[model samples]
Target: MRKRILGALFSYSVIGLITLGLIEGILQLVQLQSIRSIEIARKLYQLSSREEYLGRYCHSYIWKSNFIQAYGQHREDFLSSSGLHVPHKTRGWTTKPNVTVEVGEKQYTTNNRGHRSQKDYQEDERKYSVLIVGDSYTFGSDADDSYAWTNLLQQKDERLQVINLAVGGYGIDQMYVTLKEEIDSYNPDLVMVAYISDDVFRLKYDFRDYKKPTLQVKGGNLEIENTPIGGIEETHQEIKAELQKEDIAILKLDDLLFNLKISCRYPPYSLFSKVMGQMQLLAWEESAQFLAVYLASGAEVEEKSHESRGEEVFQRWAEENEIETLNTRPYFLQGSGYQGGHYQQAEATIVSDTVYDKIMDLESWKKFVETNR
Candidate 1:
């Protein structure tokens, strides 16, 4: 009886191993095919063969090879070569101060304060200062310095001094941190926090292109983690070592077959809500009127039902919190359209018009103008 039991156990173990091996082999073959397809696409479209560009193609794949090839390589080249963004101790990365870079026909210039502007910010008591914080959309990714909506909005009203503190690839968490750190110094009468649906998902990544600070919910409050983020190479080494500790064969198989979308343990919206609350508190403490601006991407603009879950939750939360919100989707739809997933010149003009109108219509702005007059 004992011999039979041991034999059966050995046979079952062998069967399980064989099954796993077969799955692993299949996954390897599928990944190879996927890579071939990606290469064809790259060649056909003249897509960049840069590691970062290829990494975007690998994002949907779960093979270990895909992850290994792309990990920490996605934005490293751009960050190093562009000289626009540099490592930050607290925020993980920030825009390099007073640098100018031209891409295609568009020129990006950063002021000494590290904000995207042609000129440095000088405190003008006569003007109502507006501080804007957000990701690439608010940063005006593809738009030239003169054509960005912030600059356009400023051109509309002489009484307004608009200062954009937005950085590309920033999550709402980073925006909050920036607002807290810079608000008192700028002493803006109005603060605008602009975000797209994708920015909320970015909250889940502690490491995207390079290391970044992540946020967590603790006892109904927000806690920041992964602070003083390491350099690209350091972060790469840590991730590699950690992955190496796991059973590579099983990990690859599980990732490929099971499709475990285990990016973050916490739901993104929970942290998002906490960050938004904290931002509101900070703005109030600084005596600034806070506004949340929602900008829709081309996908959301085209498909009405495809509005992001993050945006829905945010709208509800804002209403409940009595936080004023602006949806810029209508303005975008009314304009020419988005270009390369960003606002084109005409759409930017629409944004500027909408925001200027919103500000003028604000009771706070009215009171401020009245008081100043």
Candidate 2:
């Protein structure tokens, strides 16, 4: 009886193994295994730091999704070769003055002051000027220089001398510093500060590919650190030098948790959100005719379900300070076909028109111009 039971158990185990092999074979035949393997690899890729996540994660997944990409992104050539930006001592980086580069199919040209304007800025004849500051969205990422919302705003009225002081990948602290440095020289009748969601959390990081200045609040007072960490290559070398001497146990439990995707929605980030709000408010207090505007992209809504924590903070502070604020969420994907990413020419037009309408109709923006002009 013991021998018979042992034989039966062995037969059942063999059958189960055969069944599992058959299922795996079916999956392989359907190409599901390959697809799932790619998906799993992409997820693992996303678990890396943001720099690696952005610069690396999208390659395979994007290529798979957009089969149109025979090779990776063609625009990489323009991005790498474009000597359109120069390192700055205090502000981190700024657009190079008087540069004309062909990005993809479009020609992007900067004025003598390094702004991507259709024509040079005429300071003497300016009647009403708007100084717009922020990161790539404000810098008109992926859009032609002539079509960028700032330039479009200038086209809205001949008198509106709009200056675009936005650089790609700038954080809130950098924006504040840029505004402080340029506000007096630009002397605009109205100042528009544009920010996307990441600008808030970016305040916490000292390095992003290139080293940058960052800010922290201690005992309710703001403090700055890591200013002018050198240019891109220099910063890369500096980080490499530090990493070379790094301890083996640097990846703590908290670092592991941070690596998880859920950490972005964790409560601690909420505290950073509040701090970011306060930082923007402080910056606003420094400018005379400043209006905070949140640029919403279709990609943000598709990727994250919640409204940006930074936007919430900004709206609350704007209410308390009675500062003019605009959320461009509605403008996104409305007849623009802006699926995600930097705006195309049509989307840029819509955004510029929407902002122009807000300036004309919104009481806060109008009041600021009237009072400050």
Candidate 3:
């Protein structure tokens, strides 16, 4: 009886190994076939043979090497030595407070609150303050502090106190977090959420340039992920762990089965819409008027266009939510307003003028300005 039991166990073990081997073989075969198909498609359709298009699976070592090459420095050095940007427990990274850094002809100066301003925020009861939150365009990247649209807007009117809380490289998720965390302190009369279409697509990644908070839609509500975001070393370890778990054959199979696109997956619009809704709700809770400003990118300005799928979705979402929106594309298209993939001084002027006009057109803004003045 003992001998018979041992024989049965041995047979089962052998069968299990054989099944696994067969599965691996099938996966490899499928991968090979997929690569051949990609090659044929590239030749026939004139598609570029990019690594993403070819579905070249990067192993753990290769991925790490690629990351190092992309950054051009050790992770620690990159994170610690990144000028003006210090790691934040919640927002990922924010500008160092009361610090100024000069790069070429551009000067980046942060006030006491870490915003891109020269003056510390002092709430004035007599003035109607407009709080601006968004990414680099709103933060005025590649432009001087005085040339930023936020500053220009402030200069346009003395009754308006424009407070810019924008940070470079922030996604809508981070912007929402910033607004939630900072709005009550300012308690401004109006809150303007400005963004470009690319900012929406940034929702698809947990890390861009560095670690960041990501959001998801759960049961019609937005849920924050990666809370108390890890430090540089921790983030690096997490990324390494993720890469180590990669199953090349399985990854290849997934790429082939899904015919995955070259870029990161399209931005999750449901999540995006939910986040915007939450922002609107937050503003309502604080009794502050909320406005969405869609800034144009260099490409959009060059094309003289305003409509992208992301922008269209956002417009529809705003309409459904009864949220007011201002699109700056038309204003940007009126002249050569872009440079180096960001808004030049001319574009900043255009944005300020357009936004000022939009604010003047709003009844709530008019009433707020009147009451405060």
Candidate 4:
């Protein structure tokens, strides 16, 4: 009787294993994978009464680390002693000069002083110069250096020289500071401040990894915070420490499958989500300052209107200072062919054409260039 019972137990165990394998196979065939399972589990967990335990383990840092390790890159390669960018005393970071960064099969080289252009500029050059300041769009983050709007404009009119002092992830405050610092040296006949609506939202975050400074309005003045953050290594270490106590080890199989499927996967809209999250975090402080500045100017501050408010304030300041500015807000509103986020070749062409039109329309700009040249 004991022998028979032991044999029966072994048979039942084998049957259970086979059934489990069949269910997993069925799940795979039906396009329901581990990620879907996890999503469903998360929803069920949320519906439960055990709030504290769920909250503690829900957003595991280990999971985020594993996700990045699977889908993201080690930023150390792009930033370190041998990296593209170097620490700047005033700008927080700037690209290393005369370095050729290979992206895919193509290569992009920076000119002397680290600007992303083939031609180098001298203060004494006998050319009609236009100084451009803004963010990634102006820096040609998407299109090639040859295809960048600034480059297109240069191609269209060889007589006009364009100096782009734009950097990726720059806010309006940084543009203002860059123009103030570089305009005298470059001696550009016309200055263009190119901006997108997102620049207004960027004013809120310190963006520690980039070591970017932020602005806060105090006593009706824009105060610049030039301090750098701890850096990316410190952030990684902090995250690792937070997840050390949890049993959140990544499996080899998961990592392999993630890499296999990564090409088809869409990157998360983390930046937009981050902006929204940070907006909630900074609403009170920014709103108070926004209210004070607007009220002082005899302008009414409508509730939930600070995004446009921030932009309008800067626009007014630029106008008052007699600065030439080009706003790309309307173009973005109309939409472009760019995938993910940055502008494509066609969009860059549009920008180049629009800017050319604006400059030609400005009689003072035309006079300055013609007279100076």
- Give each model's whole-structure lDDT: 0.73, 0.63, 0.74, 0.53
**Model 2 whole-model lDDT (C-alpha atoms):** 0.63
Q: Each candidate's root-mean-square deviation in Å?
A: 6.1, 10.5, 5.5, 14.6
Per-prediction TM-score: 0.80, 0.69, 0.80, 0.56
- lDDT tens string, model 3, 1-373? 9999999999999999898667545545544435557655444222222344434422223334454445445444434443878778888877788888886888878888888887887788778788889988888888888888888898898888888999888889999989889988887778899998878877765666567788887776677887787766676677666655652434334443333443436676777888888888888788888999998785777685435765777778877877789988777677763564777688889899999988888766789767765
Model 4 is weakest, by summed lDDT over 10 consecutive residues, at: 289-298
lDDT by residue (tens digit), candidate 1, 1-373:
9999999999999999999888666544544435546655334222322222334432212233333566555733435656788877777678888899998888989988988888788999789889999888878888898888888888898899889999887888789878878888888888899898877776766666556777888787677888877665675576577556753443446553222334323355666788888988888887888888888786777665676766786787787788778888766665444553777677778778888888988777988889997
Looking at model 2, which ten-residue stretch has the lowest summed lDDT?
Answer: 59-68
Please provide, for model 2 over 80-175, each residue's C-alpha lDDT reduced to its tens digit, 9 standing for 90 to 100.
457777667676667887888886887788898888786787684336667778888888877887778788887888656788889887877788
Worst 10 residues of 1 by lDDT: 44-53
Model 4 C-alpha RMSD vs. true structure (Å) is 14.6
User: Better model by TM-score, 1 or 4?
Assistant: 1
Model 1, CA-based lDDT: 0.73
Candidates 1 and 3: which is better by lDDT? Answer: 3
Clashing pairs in 1: none
Candidates ranked, most accurate by lDDT first = 3, 1, 2, 4
Task: Give the Cα-based TM-score of candidate 4 against the true structure.
Answer: 0.56
Counting clashing residue pairs in each candidate, in order, gives 0, 0, 0, 0
